[model samples]
Target: MASAVFVLAPLPLGSVDLAWVCIWTAVLSASLLTARVDHGCKADLWFMVPILAAIAAIAVIVWIQVAPNILANLQDPAWGNARDLAGIDVPGRISLTRSSPLLSFGYYLVFVLGLSRAYLLGIDGWQAHKLLKLVAYASVCYALYGILSQLLLPDTLLWRQKEFYLEYATGTFVNRNTAATFWGSGGLILLIMMVRSILHKSDDADSARVRFLDRPATQAVGCGICLVAVGMTGSRAGILITVLSMVCAIVLYLAPLNRGGWLLWTSVRNSLVAGIIVLALVGSLAMGRISQIGLVDGQRYEVYKTVLDMIRGHTVLGFGAGNFDAAFPPFRPASLGSQGIWDRVHSTPLELVLDLGLPAATAVFAVAVFFFASLITAALRRKRDRHIPVIAAGAFFLGSLHSFVDFSLQIPGFGLLFACVLGCGLAQSISTSTRGLARRAPDWDSPILR
Candidate 1:
């Protein structure tokens, strides 16, 4: 039930609040139902203490008012009397500069708790597999909906007036790129499942024929639909990144079959044939839109420069969490030449620096890199459940790359999904033993066994 909500929550404007409620409910329900709660990591408290402390520090910075003298020192000299002239209602108290600091904290807390829950759930392989299946099928449903909507109701989005990207497949999302990334992650899972089916062949030919319309074929069809939807979104980066992820999955799937040269060749040949068919279908639907990859938006570069300037001024402490829009107007570059509101900088890393300062942002980045490295190591060394780490790695790679050029990671749906995958990867890394260790295991009578 929670998995269903998580998968479908992205449809309603990315479901910022809805996702939080669903996750909170799921966590509480799981806690009540289970007798033994598996935290999944022995070092969980050691790792979590600092993270929680950081969150506490941020909360203090956001909710409490700094001394006037200290606040004055932090302000730019150019703002001169603005800080003094902006009269305060209370003598020693002033809210954060952010437009909605409490809201920002709420979102951050939700993500933290959600990741924790996902990690615990991922410790059970069966549960993780079920979650993966849910994600894939949900994506397929959304993909089909997006495709049909584009074909049948070009001017409407989810049966409402289309605000933007009229011709693109937005898939219940306001932005086509978000839809593409979400479905792209889903497509990767389906691709992995398809590859697994190919690698693990059934012995009984009669039974295999009887179950021809089984899970594998269904996954293949879902993957095709997702690819077509991604291509139709007209997002150049989305198509390229998704294709790269697919290629990575294919290489990983084929690399292990190299012991048998003929078998490896056969697998490659079959994969190529399937790839060609899927690509042809995607191409027909996209109508050569992938060629637009070369086009670059200069406005984004200007925005990035402005964000850098903001970061430099607040090198130690940021303006405030969720304060980008409020803090941006003063730093808006003249070169931008736009009167429209600049809400997001289109770069999550730069935005993070602006929100949490360099130190905090660095801490976050380091943790992420550590988990990614651990997952990569586990994927290469572990004999069983290797696909789990591979899928997680692929998801992380897609989100990380997309974040550089776009704000897909900032969207709650994509952010939550990425966190879930990361948690699963972390769980897999801790639970699986290295091949060498497994080989060295002794028999029941051995001293080591005791």
Candidate 2:
């Protein structure tokens, strides 16, 4: 039930829906605790502790700045010019963020706790697979809605006012890039399922024969639909990253197959050909939008430079979390032409540095790198239940790569989904008891593993 709500909570594009989802998630987490489920904390708690501590430190920094005496005592001369440029008085109680820092902290807490609960759920193999299937199905449904809405009602968003990007498939998301990210994730999941189906070998004589209409074919159709929806989003980064993720999935699938070198090469060639064909079809419909990737968008580049300046001013402690918009106006470059509000720097990494400063951001990044590395190592080494890790790795790659150029990670829906995948991957990597449980339980390996 919690999984379903998590999958659908992004549709409304409001905070209330996410808050309700968080409440239900907390309830579900409490129930799991009562059941005494292994939360996979033994493997990741060390890393998580530092991240939590960093958040706490940032909170402290925000709180202290609110007190005039503390702010004056800690004032730096280097910040004087930036303060004058921003037109804000020194030692004032106002936080750097446009919104309340306490609210941002609450949201971050919910996200972290939600991720921990997902890890617990994923320690159980059956539960993990069920959650993956549910998320995949929900993503596909959203993709269909996006495609249909764009074709039938291009002028409206969920039957409401269409303020912008009417021609693109934004789905239930406010941004086309975010919608593409969601669809791309769904495509990766379907791709993994399709590969697993193809590689499946059944011992039963009746199941040994391959049929024209099979699970793999069905998954392939779904994957194609998702890819098409991603292309329709008309986002260059989205299409490229999604394609790269698919290629990664194909490579992961081909790696462990016990096939001859010639056969493997042929399979790779065929997969590449299929990918090209899909791209060509979608590209035609996109009408040269993919070609725009070669051009540089000066506005985002300018914003990136201004954000770097902001980071330079606050080398130790950042302005504040969720403070990008409020902290940006003073550093806004005249070259940006003063036409639009640069709320986000459009790069998650830079924004993290801006919000948390270098030290805290570095700590957070190190933890992420360690987590992903652990999962990838497990995926490569594990003899059984390898698909879960592979899928998680692919999903992580999609989100991480997109973060370098877009703010997909800042969006609650994408962030929650990414965290869920990360938790599941970590759980699969480190949960010894779950493996033991699987062995003691009934041998319910699907036909794919038989």
Q: Indicate which candidate wins on TM-score.
A: 2
Global lDDT of model 1: 0.67
State each model's CA lDDT, in order. 0.67, 0.70
TM-score of each: 0.81, 0.85
Cα error, residue 170 of model 2, in Å, equals 0.5
Model 1: worst 10 consecutive residues (lDDT sum):
441-450
Error of 2 at 123 (Å): 0.3
Error of 1 at 2 (Å): 3.1
Candidate 1 ranges beyond 4 A from true positions = 17-36, 39-72, 75-83, 86-99, 201-214, 256-293, 432-450
Candidate 2 structure, TM-score to reference:
0.85
Task: Give candidate 2's whole-model lDDT.
Answer: 0.70
lDDT string, candidate 2, 1-450, tens digits: 457545865677522344654664566456446543544445556545654675577677556534453454334343465567887665444346434555556556656665666676777765776677677767888889889999989888885887778878888888888888888998898788777777666454567555543378778888888888898898877887787777776776566563478877776787778767766776553436635545346788888888888788776657666678877886788898859867788999998887666887887788788778877786666655677778888899999999988898777767777777777777777644534554322212234222
